[model samples]
Target: MKRMKKVAALLLAVVMLASTAACSSDKSWAAKNDSLTVPIGSYIYELYAAYYSASSQTGDTAAGSASSQAAESSVLDRKIDGKDAKTWIREKALNSTKSLFVIDRKMKDLKLTLTDAEKASIKTNTDSSWANYKSTLEGYGIAESSYQLAAAEYSAKYQKVFQATYGKSGAKAVPDDELKSFFEKNYTDFSYVLCKLYKTDSSGNYSASFTDSEKKKAEAEFNDYASKISAGTMTLQQAADAYKSVDSTISVQNDTANLKTNLQGYPDDLVKLLDGMKAGETKAAEISSGYLYILATKNDIAKKTADEMKTDDGRNNLLADYKGQEFSDEISKEADSISGVTINEKAIDSYDPSMFAAEK
Candidate 1:
């Protein structure tokens, strides 16, 4: 649980950097179309999270070093994707926030109220998950109302979108075969042991140079570990457990529990590497700054049985995510096209990243 919290905070920062913001003393920003009111506090919290996360030289600090070291699909800097980093962040936040409003409006337009089970979900973070969250936020002196409002906004947006896209108030779920087919092409379930070699900043920028000695040193260390795995002497779990640090030593810092194939930030080269390998096989590929020796635990690219799809619950869940993503994408495109989103300078101008550091 402690470890999960650290990972959550770090990832939250990454998500913040990768994506949000509004301005005003009220800590709100408005969409010109009167569709949404973006929360300034959450927006700034995300910015600071990303800022401190990336600014750290090493993830060695329990909060950061390891958190930033996960293997991804694309290790590219998005700030250079066309717009500047700030612009990209703002655009994504506005679109996402507005999207929730749009979805919520749709729900009302349809005159739909969530079922009992659905309403119960709003208290999810507020209870045990939220208890911990509230305690942590209070430690930072953040107003309870601020984050609460943000959570409510997220809940309303998410639930409505899920209902509209996948739920039918009382509709029967799709058949298992149909879901299996959808899962087969669009989804994959796999676990891998990643050996990352790069020293990236919070923003994912790589080092300016690498020396031959460094390359040889990295290769020699990785080879030793790879040989152990190949010889079937040391398991990936054992490897990951033995050495948690990669910079000072080669270790299993990350492994995939699951991955959505079509998701962004997955390295295309790594995907290609994993594609050819079968389950329980170990393969090595030299990445930008280091070698990645992966053990493919489950390769689900092959067709799944009707049992694997597990019928309605799993299908509905995936469908919610799928439809939510599609809706988000549509909204993001619209956000990109929108002009003149107003931000209040006073609301978040004096923000500091250190205030919200997690309790040790």
Candidate 2:
């Protein structure tokens, strides 16, 4: 009778162990939609990315270098746009997951597949990342396969959808003449030599002060450079070299091709000047609140050949200026439209961003 009791007890223990294992398996999934189960590891990977991205945006120096506990605390203690950092990060990660789902669904709908070259690139990138962060990721309970899955979503699937929607041969390809016209109107190829009239501290913080003599000297010197460039007496590079020789503190940025309208880091006055100036014409002006004097020469790429407009660089600029926002909005809309998806809050809540903190 005692032997029978022992056997029964052992059987009960086995059943309990199996039940616990099943629960763990369920918890391993972060979300589910119909037959699809999104792994907790995948969500965790996205969370890790979102945390670091937010950290970088907020200029948190300890973001990628801090200890796991410190990293976690840093994000948790902060607020982004009036939202708690933890909540913000979690929402960002989940939204990224939804985007991945959209990418996958769109790729299927479009009958798109990654080329062999694209597949190879993804593998190479994933292998490198996995090798570098394997230990940290494993500690955070992220498997290599999960990381690869996320990487593929971003690198391959997303890009394929974008190309299918907007490539030269895509259904929604912009007309060549329209792209050319947009390029001509909004893009400029130019070079400039800037003589800053302000003083800066050791940390390069500019102070808006220049003596009358200093301003006069800068204006005269820059105007001479501009006249020489306009007369073809010196190339833009030569002028830059000459200016640097005369005033080592002067800033010269030549060969600035394909400058778009209202580009950051360029003064509004300079953009306006470029707009009015013809190709091969050189002009000197005071810009940046009269703190900078510039000698600028516009290049003759305002009217490029049709083939030139079809180059990779040209296409990229168009995407950045035109179709990129449209694509992003479309993806966001698609992600929002996905239905029957449910989050495993229990699983997600159990994970933490600090678990994948960078190793010191």
Each model's lDDT? 0.51, 0.76
Indicate the worst ten consecutive residues by lDDT in candidate 2: 254-263
Question: Candidate 1 lDDT, tens digit per residue, 39-112?
Answer: 55555534534433333323324432233332110111223347543444444444554454555565676677
* TM-scores, one per candidate: 0.48, 0.71
Per-residue lDDT of 87 in model 1: 43
Superposed Cα RMSD, model 2: 6.1
lDDT of 2 by residue, 1-360 (tens): 999999999999999999977776577888777656778889888998888887876667676564656765676678888898877887788887777777777777898878888888888888987898898888778898788878764767776777777777888887777777777666677777788787777777976588999889879988887888778788767777777865576555754334464545576788889889998899999998888888888877654545456688757567557677788888877776688788777788887655545545
lDDT score for residue 94 of model 1: 44
TM-score of model number 1: 0.48
